[model samples]
Target chain A: MPKESDDLSTLGELGESAVLGRIFPRLPAASAQLLGPGDDAAVVAAADGRFVVTTDLMVHGPDFRLAWSLPHDLGWKAAASNLSDVAAMGAVPTALVVAIAAPADSPISLLEGIADGFRDACGALAPGCGIVGGDLSVSDTLTIAVTAFGDLAGRPPVLRSGARPGDVVAVSGALGEAAAGLRVLFAEALDANGAPDAVLASLVRDRTTAQLTPSPPIADGPLAASAGATSMVDLSDGLAIDASRVARASGVRIDFDRGALGADPDLALGGGEDHSLLATFPPGARLPGGFRPIGTVVAPADDEGNVSVILLDGKPYTVSGWDPYTGWKDSGVAGGSAG
Target chain B: MPKESDDLSTLGELGESAVLGRIFPRLPAASAQLLGPGDDAAVVAAADGRFVVTTDLMVHGPDFRLAWSLPHDLGWKAAASNLSDVAAMGAVPTALVVAIAAPADSPISLLEGIADGFRDACGALAPGCGIVGGDLSVSDTLTIAVTAFGDLAGRPPVLRSGARPGDVVAVSGALGEAAAGLRVLFAEALDANGAPDAVLASLVRDRTTAQLTPSPPIADGPLAASAGATSMVDLSDGLAIDASRVARASGVRIDFDRGALGADPDLALGGGEDHSLLATFPPGARLPGGFRPIGTVVAPADDEGNVSVILLDGKPYTVSGWDPYTGWKDSGVAGGSAG
Candidate 1:
């Protein structure tokens, strides 16, 4: 929660080894780690005989703005994004490895904040997770790439292509919060160096900042899988885009009821980066406790038919949402997308 | 092998999705991938229930120079660096996840070459290894961060603290070649476009390029471990620096023979990025086939003694090698170091 300060020691002044010296001690001790950070690599005991792995690259400006978010939040968001993917696979996160590239003139406090974010996310969301190893190098822009490894605990992984006709589409947590928060954060960026109204500031604190640094529904993934969920995905992209991805993969149409998703149709249907679990389960299967049904899976429409892979209240719903390519063009920075 | 050309399409023109489309099909199908790329994450079978993980961050300017290297070589070097670390742990690399940050205006062919490098590396070094997943973003500079996962096959991981007094030190492959190569490449950087003499070009091609794109002895790690090697590390930092690390960790001193290291004492003892495996074996132990003895581990120095961790020709050697911090202050660029 610490804000940026003007006077701080740059990474150049301290050096890579010394910066590492600052980062090493703050990491949590992971029981699954047989050998933690240091040495050439780290060893993690993967008792389930399988490892779920994912990585994300976040760059400054387009993917994030240092002026808008704290380094700790960046770290937390990085962890949350990757960990949610692991959780989406019905796995328990066990270890994380970070490779950070930053300018030598970058502050060591920025890195410490990133470390704090990693510790915070792992501590609050996945206590079993540990930051096992990392590499740091000098870059012109700040970039952090995180690879998270998870254990499946003997259960088969839940994939995106398992949805079938008659399967129910459900979500384990809130859907549009991240998208709303991002819009709020960007709006505040316009008032840079000034104060926002109380209402806007409160919304940023309660909604936007939370998404900028997310806490995904990691536990619901395994719970849903164990409850006989067929296919699953975390909503990093808008619901429409990601859901269509699942629909295309499974070759099924997912019909959504407008009333079921409640108000804020755009957020629920087109928003992205919520990190909420969306799964398809066989009809009448004992649904997981936390998941709420939002739609139903149906067979792909006939070639001659005009039915879409996604529908809103039984009608083809074609709506636009945040796209990395198109979205970044207007931001005045390179419109590159982040994971 | 292609040089930068004006006709090449840039990444911004192609967009992220299109770039990914081109990169995906080039990857060889890996059998160990229970679930391959294109999902939330990749599922890699770790039958032994243990994973040896290592990550490295490579920046364009300091860690590498685009002016000197081809894009394919950069990709190859990134994979070789991380895979070598897995091999250093006495494990077989199974999967890799890369997070690449580049300027949007960067040519798509550069990325294609990088993908080819990753592919070529896995094909040549670790037959079954596959790039399971990755994330791409735009940055002011091009950066590639690779994280590789490996299988230990139920063996105790080789650590750096196991070497004891009286142990013989050995290396699995060539040493000092990389440092010499760097010198050659750096020499070439001075000329810009003027082609070097035949001799320098050949040296740059055979020696420098070889270092830029290394082929570490991956299988030799397990062989050494099985042959009772006590301590091991990849000679990424010159022989002296890495050897000193092992010496301090094992509470012993390493004595090197200038004669055994081949020509160029400076390159052999003080060069960095060789990536060859340097290990210690107990006295009278049957050394693995590929390894050759270079030194011996001796008792730690007494408090009144002035023995250094590394010795040359029976005398304490204190000549300096690359120290990232002190090394880069004058580079004008970030002047950062790599591990």
Candidate 2:
């Protein structure tokens, strides 16, 4: 932490305007934005008479640890997570409104880096989606809450409840990568006192970056929708759990082939934070380029009296999904609580 | 705080689904919603092909104190603050996406009350606006981040930059009320340890509720826009400060009449957080029913070399606006830091 006397300016020292002045320039301008920041509110072009909206929060403790993830990685993951939601709705993300509350003593560079990350992530993952407005606040906890908007482009929104009995369940992007990366970070990137070691975390950059800065297959969502997809969901939770959601919502059962899953089937089944797109497409339809068939949607067997919504190779598979409340622990590995 | 075994279940004990199941039922259905919660994203109708969007944050420390504010008040204020932004854009608020991150120990009833507050606030303030989507996270600090979206309704967005030299600056909603209420809270609602006392706060309900659950003239925004108002801004800051923003944005000077401002002229000018709409209309144009003329937009005296954008009875007034970063202190009077 750089002192106020040094070159690095803390948020407390610079105030909101100065800090925003540094960050506003770094953010990418959204093409869909009619009126951008600096006003009471920003106006974004919905274009098709409707807009897809979703909000997500990343708190300091449960979401990510500053030790394991840098400001850039946090921003990237935050944007990636929200953009994936819009994509899952089969909409092109147009703009995002980000509200970040950080400790007053935090360096202004933290916000600047986060802004740059937002700019780059939008450039790479969801091209043309940019931040239109945001709010800043002072808090003991560093919290990033992002609300994302998207344009449907005249396509009907792909919903989780649209899957049918004959639908083929497919996935886009890496399933177990983020979870595997988190496990590696927990196992390798801890200091002597059990705190996360950023330096050591960076040493396993390949693994850690996946957990810190996931690139969800954003374009695949609209493609899946365009290719006569029935239901779509962002796989923020593991394959089994998210698939179960689609199954439950659609009144169907999802049967996954073990062979379709990668080498670490258990990790693919139970681990989460992958942010992939899980969609149910019509059988025999060309699976979008980025998507691969992983499972099949089957009619629920009412006579069998089995309550399971997920099956692995014709057997009942029960696995829990990510619930922030139940999933969080006071002090844990990987992204531990800052407090 | 309720124990785990009590009738009131903590968030950690009930898990995310159960908590969400409780909150989802309490929220009002938005008329503009095509797809509501329990999905990847919500779809809202932007009838005119564009949506006015904004986001605002209320962190526990700098924004409010749980000791002084009930969960319902917190929810209402959060929604009110964000809705005002959309209203200031001269658009009708249609939906809100609220993300709340609270401690794991927080009771499910806290979220339930917040939901009820959001329900009631949207019902009373912005009739058709309702919660569309939201996210929850575990955090030490209680944070409420709200993003509001509005429909243009085929009208041009009233912008801060649109105030011209001859525009009659007016305000809709009470000025200095919230700030005065905050002063009352700081003056009376404190215990021996300098912490807020809810019991004491309740005694001054009239004063404190203005600071807690402010009902900004949400309807007056679109009304002003329809009435041919040239410019508009939400008075989240003081009249002098927010007017200065309009002045700066429009490249004009704003001169306020001291007599027109209620009895407490200085308080009305310098105090903040009224959430009122400060708008400018064409000279001699009939002011909206709720709007009262307070000032006038004048040509900037470039030759005089004075850069101050705001004036009170022909004299320069440069009162500062709210800045969470610079304004916050570790421990203060009204809504002090919980840490």
Candidate 3:
């Protein structure tokens, strides 16, 4: 009899179906998981009578690179991306379903590594939130699609539209590390065959770690909700971009004090993939620990309903954060420092 | 202002964020879609106070190839795989969230074609169902990941563990078309420059069509549930293999009558990817239209507790079905009269 490893090549060798067989057996049985991995779909008991759902897809080049990131890191990133959406809504993630597409030649170990990453991330983010179900198919590239479900605990879901003028702006969790980490990875890859400075290398590695696995402050989302947060959004597409969304929805302008932003300006404004909660609170509201005041909201400009960022000196900053259409260039200094 | 066509490039050129921006505006608004696209997560209403969920991934090479399949077909297959799972649970598909990963150099039109495929498939299979949200990223290859949600409509979910001895076996749709289609696609790709026979060529074309865009018969799943199916599953991995699963779960033997299993033997027992519902009903129970009787359940044999396949003429046919570890050739031709 062939050993299991011999019987099953890496996910790439056995293809999608074989990989699924390996994964299905290891999952925990849940009452909510009326149907598990094998069938067309898995049925879960949607407690609170409603389910909060979100999805994110991670691709190889733009989202990750097998050469630079481990399978586990990919898994962690995939789970965090979806779970953060649940957190942004002030809901507790309960379950997740993943859809992974990889080349037929991908190794089984890599698939397992990705699964392990998912398990580790889930364990850290939401205990018991295991992968209830997913589908695997061969594709030209490696892609992960994840959908996360959460329970609101019957509380009204927090949305981006709830902010009002005079609401205090706040954020939870660090920003800019992931973006900075990505920069380092690219630079390192470009200068292959030569070693960089030890300290610089470590700094780059730390940033990449942030890029690969983001820890969304789930607790802070619920904390803000309980404290009567007026509006909430996750800092995924940079603080300025996401905050602009909140401002547009709430019909307000958000003014930022560069001094109040964390030690990193880039981390606060243009940094992305942070998965932090950027929220608003009414004046004099007592914020939970880790929740720090960053800015204030005011009426939107008469010509535009969208949010505009104002500096402490009351001038609009020329930088518009990260825009996918317009590429990001190193602006002389790292963004984490005060402007 | 460049024309959309001139401006468009492969998904890779636009990058992850740009692709997202292009696709996000095309989606329709649904009350159930609390948050649509562009966030860490999307919020959907699971109105039945419960949510039925399932996911599937489509990869390149193994699941699909760019040479024979269009981007639209890939999209269709991705959505179909997940929606079929929802149908297997006797649930009505309501919404879908997709995550896509493709090479950075992939054309935006191809991505749009993939989205169009989702839109078209959803429109045809479940009209009210919508592609509520998604994420796009770049990878070394093209991969599609989809998660589908369904409503139970107050009916108890049909599971795979409810089959009993003396239960009748039935299926609701055509089988073997997808496997047949795959064979054609490979054969054509292998002989890309050669001219094949007209009839064979047409069949191959049809087969590729079937494989590229599987039309999962979702309605039958719910019909079986309403008609009191004792046990049920989708024919994703061939009948003999899937039947064995039901037998093991229900502690019974599933004896398939070759005569009653449609007109094609290859389709009846060995073909996979049909996405047809195979269900068990009480003996002499009324079955929904299109559900043809194919087998019967019997008491388990020996102490192994494994489901055994009893063939016509008192012969015991060892289970032969599609297994990734061992390719599908033997299973595809086993227990069948070669034309």
What TM-score does chain A of each model score against the native chain A?
0.90, 0.94, 0.86
Candidate order by TM-score, highest to lowest? 2, 1, 3
lDDT of 1: 0.79
In what order do the candidates fall by lDDT, top score first?
2, 1, 3
lDDT of 1 at A79: 89
Error of 3 at B294 (Å): 1.5
Tens-digit per-residue lDDT, A215-318, candidate 1: 78888888888898899998887777788889989989898877777687656887777788889999998778578889999888888365468887777877
| Index of the highest-DockQ prediction | 2
Worst 10 residues of 3 chain A by lDDT: A325-334
Best by lDDT: 2
CA shift at B192, candidate 1, in angstroms? Answer: 6.7
Model 2 per-residue lDDT tens digits across residues B129-226: 99888988899998888899898799999999999998899998988888888888888999888888989988988777788889999999999999
lDDT of 1 by residue, B1-339 (tens): 534334478778877778888788776556578988888999888888888999998887668767667788888898888888898888888888888878778888888889888888888888899888888887777889899888888888888999999999999877877777776755664454553344444445865765678888878888887888899999887788888888888888898878898987756887778789999999998888589999899888886365577887777877455534335533221111212
Q: What is the C-alpha lDDT of each candidate?
A: 0.79, 0.85, 0.70
Residue-by-residue lDDT tens digits, candidate 3, A31-52: 4565566655677767776677
State every prediction's TM-score relative to the real structure.
Answer: 0.91, 0.95, 0.86
How good is model 2 by TM-score? 0.95
Candidate 2, residues A1-339, lDDT tens digits: the string is 111123478999999888888888888889999999999999999889999999999898788889888778888899999999999999989999888898999988788778877888999998899999998889888888899988889999999999999889899988788888888887899899888898998899876666889999999988998999999999887787788788889999998888999897777877688889999999999998699998999999886565788888888876665778987863222221101
